[model samples]
Target: MSQKVREIRLDQIEANPNQPRKLFDETKIADLAASIKANGLMQPITVRPLPRKVGEQGRYMIVAGERRFRAHKHMGAETIRCLAVEMTEDEMAVKAIIENLQRADVTAMEEARAFQSMLDRGYTVAALMKELGLKSRNRVLDRVNLLRLNPEFQTLVEGGNLPPAYACEIATLPAALQVKVIRQVSTGQLKTAEQVRHAVIALREALAQDDIFAAMPAATEKEVAVVNRMEAKVEQIAALAALGFKDNECTIAKKVDPNKVKGMADKLALIRNHLLQMEHALRAAAAQGEILAA
Candidate 1:
């Protein structure tokens, strides 16, 4: 396989049909094209020979330069600098994927899909793991797991609204529960990933009990519902407080007596304490059930 750098016409070069990467941002591509127009192509693309067929002249197939090709097209450049090479289909696919991964802004889903593609193309998980500088098999495995996430959740991740840590948390949940958690997050019921994680763990623990329905206290449901509502209200108040409203000022500004605010604060604290006690009692009941079952 000879390697020679040459200036090839942009119209003549074609993107590899087997490129593992699926999505590309037009804005980023246009930006890159503008940059390339201002500064000549610093790096050349890699390509392989395309076998000719009857009644048609073949064109060069890109192996590792899809971004540059698209950018140059956006720039309206007639020709592009490329490095011609010869490689088998499998090698070309890997090179195409690795080239995209080298970009700074590649999405996690893209990376996951690319890795999965390589795996499907006969690469071992261990081999790809080493190639990607992954520390453990589980790290590689986790990327693949992202593919299992619902498209709505995946879109959230790709859009940068949801963090990967949160996505991982959602990944452990059943699809139906994943939708529930996402809805809560979207509706501001769950403020942080930590809150979601705690809720998930608590729910799992509750469900694991043999007679979970009976093991739980009769008042537990009502208590928990009240606590959730109160917590939401507290969060709203805290947000208001963060905007420079003191408890006393808010109360007085609303024409309520300052003493009333103090009294309410004391009452809320007491309610919070009672909620904690209710939680503890529920836990104790569950533990007793576990002991009896054992």
Candidate 2:
């Protein structure tokens, strides 16, 4: 790599195609330019020679220091100090990504994309961890997983409006329902990452519930709380049933009246009869051979 601190013409330099940074704040740029104008560009930008095309000759592409370049452009300077270096395209991409990532404002989505781009080019996770100076594989994987977020939520995460961890937790939900989870988060209905995860689990359970229950209209907060308590009881009963425990084992279970148990049995028998009737109805419909065998 040839590295030289050379003064290059601003007009001859072009923006890097593989730069990980997509959005730049004009206000921040103006501030940086003011700083540079007063301090005289404390650090230099990095650039590489570009192959001449048509009327252009001795042109360069920025490998790093895009912010400074923009600042200089804001100042209308004719030339800027550049650390000229010779690097391959891949090397240039890595340098640009690394440079951008070193900044505090680099978005999670940008980091994820930069990591993914290197990974797609045959780089291993371990290699990425080392190059990116990450302490663990989980850190790298977590950033990369941000790509799984829905576009709307991804934008939120990338813009720093939504926490990346919240988005990551919500991304585990079904693709169709991720946005709803994000909405819940954005509205402060879901507070923590754990809450978002639990909400997702509950949403999935609701989606997996029997059609008769799932099709019901939305309930009030108190109604939802009641249903949640009932669901918990149903789960406990299901576990007990699986264990072949016919009688009550706990104090709460023992508090139930015997007549209540008998009434529940009668209701269960009625439900069984209803199921049989449904099967019979389906069998009647099977005459045309449209319905398959159970």
Best by TM-score: 2
Error of 1 at 171 (Å): 1.8
Best by lDDT: 2
lDDT of 1 by residue, 1-294 (tens): 678888888767888776756678899899999889888788999988778888875479999878889998887888888898878887787788788788787777777778888898788998997776666787667767877789888888888787777677777766766776677677787788797786556445544653576776676778989989988987886686566556545443466577697886788699779878977987866754542232
List the candidate 2 regions with Cα displacement exceeding 4 Å: 53-55, 203-294
lDDT of 2: 0.79
lDDT (Cα, tens digit) per residue for candidate 2, span 142-228: 878888877877778877889887877776666777877776676787899888776666665545553455788878899999979
lDDT of each: 0.76, 0.79
Model 1, TM vs. native? 0.65
TM-score (C-alpha) between model 2 and the true structure: 0.68
lDDT of 2 at 287: 28
